[model samples]
Target: MRTILILSMLFCSIGPANAAKTKKPKSEEQKTLYAIGADIAEQIINQFLFEEKERPYVMKGFQDRLAEGKLDIEVKDYRGKIRQMIVDRQQALRNKFLDEATAREGAKRFPTGLIFTETLKGTGEKPTLKDKVRVHYHGTLTNGQVFDSSVARNAPAEFRVDGVIACWKQGIPLMAVGGKAELICPSGIAYGKAGRPGKIPPYATLVFQVELLAIIK
Candidate 1:
C-alpha cells in the first residue's frame, strides 16, 4: 500500500502531461510547482550519487524493484540496509587511501592519527592551540576532489587552531609561521561520520596542503 501511494504521488506530480508541455510558457503557479519538483529531483539525485560510486547500478536496481512490485520489505529496513552499504564502502576507501598516504617517505604519523609532512621549514614561533593564525590551504578528499581552498580564493584564512577539526588542532602546532606542510587526516580527526553536507561526504578522509603565514599573536 505504501509503495502504491508513493508511486501514485510521483505520477500525479510529474507524469506524461507535464513532460509533453515542456516547450510551452507556464503560468506563475505552474512555474512554482515545476521549480519545486526540479528541486526535489536534484536533491534525490545528489543523495544517491554522493557516496554510491555505482549510483547508476543502484538506481537501476531500485527501478526494477519498483516496476516488479517487490515492496515486501519495510521502507525503514530498506533504507537502513542501503545506509550500511554506503558506510562499508566509505570505510574501505578511507582505509585504502590512508595506507597509501602513510607509506610515503617523509610522512610522519602522530599518536592521534594525524599524519603530516613538512614541505618547507620555518624559523618563526609556532602558535598554540588557543592562538589565532593565518594560513593558506587547499583541502581535498582522499580521492583528490578538492572541497575547499583558501589559495583559490586568493586569501589566507584566519582562525584559532582549536576551533578547527581535531586534526588541525594537533597538526598545525607542529609548523612555525611561514612553514608549509601536507596533512593527511583520518575521518575520526576530520569530519567523522557526519561530514559537511553537499561539500564533504560522511566518513571521508581529508588531505590538505597548508602554509602558515602568521601566529596572529
Candidate 2:
C-alpha cells in the first residue's frame, strides 16, 4: 500500500516538472539568468579557441559554482601565468615565420631587419624619405591572411615616405617607380607588440607586396 502511494506521488511530481522544462523562461529573473548564460557562452567559448572535449569540463566548473556557490579554482591565482603563456607562444610563432622568410631566394636583410625580395625590377627613380609617393600594396600576415589591400579597391594610396610604418619608410626607398617587391616586416618595425586591435594581433610579422607607381613631387 505504501509503495503504491509513493509511486503515485513520484509520477505526479515528474509530470509537471517535465512539462515546465519544455516551456521557455518566463519570469524576469529567469530571463536575466538565461541571457547571462548566453552572453558568457558566446564571449568565452566563441572568442577563444577551445577544444570540443574541453567543453564538458568547462560546464562542470560552471555548474559547481552555481550549485556550491564557490569556484573550483580561483581565477586570480593563474590569470597572470596563463596570460604570459599566450604571449610567449605568439612571440615564438612570429620569430619562426620571420626566420623562414629571411631564407627565401633573393631575400635581403636590410639594416633595419626588413626582408626585401624584388619580384619586378623598376626602371624609374626611387622615392626619397621626404617625397610623397603613390603606390598599390597588398598586405598579409605570415599565414597568408590578407589584412589590407589598396590594390583590391583599385585605388592607389599616396603618403609621404616618412609618414608610414617603419618598414614602409625604409622599404619604399628601395623600390623604383615601376618596381614590385615583397617586404617582410618584423613586429618591431611594423605595428610593434600592440598591433592594430581588430585588423592584426600582437607580435605579428607582416608581408606586403608593394608596387611603386610614382614619387609624387
Candidate 3:
C-alpha cells in the first residue's frame, strides 16, 4: 500500500507535460533533455527509497507543502534534518560494533575512540607523523560495506601519516613496517559531519584493514 502511494506521488510529481498527452522526443536535443529529466526523476526516487519506511511521513509533508502553494521550504532546513538523521543512525551502529569488537580478546581501544586489532606483527620500526608511508588498505563502513580499497586497485598508497584522517594519524604510528592491523575509526576522527558525499555518508564510522609496507621521510 505504501509502495503504491509512493509510485502515485512519483507519477503526479512528474507534472502534466509528462502525462499521457505528452509527445515523445523526436530530435537529438529533445532526446538529451528527456534523458536528463529521467535522470533527475530517478535521483529523487532513489533518495526517498533509501529510507522507504520513513518516506511516507516525508511525502505527506511534501504533499502538505504542495497543497499550501505559498509554503516556503528551506533547503538548509531539510538538509540539516537529513544529516542529523544519518549521523544519529551511524553513531548508534558505530557504538554497537565497537562494543562487540573491543570485547574480543585481541582488540584494543585508544583514548581517542580508535579501535585497533593486529593481524600481523612486524619487527621493523613504526613511522612517525613526519614520515610518508606506503601501505595497502581496504576501508569500509561499520556495516561491512566497502567504500575504498588500495588492495582492490593492486597499488599501495603513499602519504604522510599526519596527512590522512585523525584515526590514521594515531593508529598508523602504532603499526610497524610489514605489520597488518584493523583500525576502527569513530566519525569524529574520520570524515565527521561532512562525509565524502556519495561515497561515505555523514557521521560514518570507518573500518580499515591496513598493511604497513614501507616508511620514507
Candidate 4:
C-alpha cells in the first residue's frame, strides 16, 4: 500500500514543477573552444591559403601550435625568415620611392617661382589651443601622387589649428579666411621615417596648397 502511494506521489510531482532539471548546466568549455578555434581557422588560414576541405587539418595544426603559446615563425624559425624578407623588400621600396619623389619636387619648384604666390598679403591669425577651423587643401608627395584634397574629396577638413601636424599648425594660421598659401613640409614635419602607405614613401617630404576657407569659432 505504501509503495503504491509513493508511486502515485512520484507521478503527480513529475509535472511542470519537476520537469525542469534542478542542477545548473555545466559549461561546455571544450566544445566552445573547438567552435572558437574553427572560427579563427576560417578567418586566418582558410581565407588566406586553404580550401574548405583543408580546414580540419589546418585547424588541427593550428591548435597544436597555439597550445605552445608561440608561433613557429616568431622563434627565429624558417617562417620567421620569410616574413623578414617580405619586410625588407617593403622597406627598400619605401626608400627608393622617397628618393624619386624628392628629386622630382626639387625639379618642379623654387627655380620657376611658380610654387610661392606672393599676391595675397593677408596676415595669419594664430588660433588658440581649443579652436577648430575649416580649411581647403590639396596634398601630394614629391613623386606626384596626390593623397589628400579637400576640394577633390568635396569636403572640408575641420581640425584644431594649434594641435595638428607641425606643418599644418605652422602653416594654416599664417593666412586669413579666403586667403591661399602653400606649404612644403619636409619629412620631419610630414609623415616621416614611417611614411603613409602607397601614396607617400617613407621619409618623404610633402607638398600642399591650402586655402583658409573659414574659421568655425
| Top candidate by lDDT | 3
Alpha-carbon RMSD, candidate 1: 6.2
Model 2 residue 8 CA deviation in Å: 43
What clash pairs does model 4 have? 124-174
TM for every model, in the order presented, reads 0.67, 0.67, 0.64, 0.45
User: Whole-model lDDT for model 2 versus the true structure?
Assistant: 0.79
True lDDT of residue 196, candidate 4: 80
Q: Which window of ten consecutive residues has the lowest lDDT sum in model 4? A: 106-115
Residue pairs with backbone atoms closer than 3 Å in model 3 (clashes): none
Off by over 4 Å in 1: 1-79
**Rank by lDDT, descending?**
3, 2, 1, 4
- Model 3 over residues 1-217: C-alpha lDDT tens digits? 2444355455456445445676898999989977866765565553333465876666555566556565456645776676565446656656888899889878999889999999999778899999999999999987688999999999999998989999999999999999999999988899997999889977778999999999975
lDDT of 3 at 101: 87
**How well is each residue in 1-217 modelled by candidate 4, as lDDT tens digits?**
2343233333333333443543443579756754554454343431233357965654444454545565534433554654554456545654564445446532323421223332254555645556788878898875567988998998988888877776676666556777776666666766777888777766566778888777786
For every candidate structure, what is the RMSD over all alpha carbons to the true structure, in angstroms? 6.2, 12.2, 7.0, 19.2
| Alpha-carbon deviation at 43 in model 3, angstroms | 12
The total of clashing pairs for model 1 equals: 0
Record all residue pairs in model 2 with backbone atoms less than 3 Å apart, i.e. clashing: none
Using TM-score as the measure, what is the rank order of every candidate, best first? Answer: 2, 1, 3, 4
| Native-structure RMSD, model 3 | 7.0
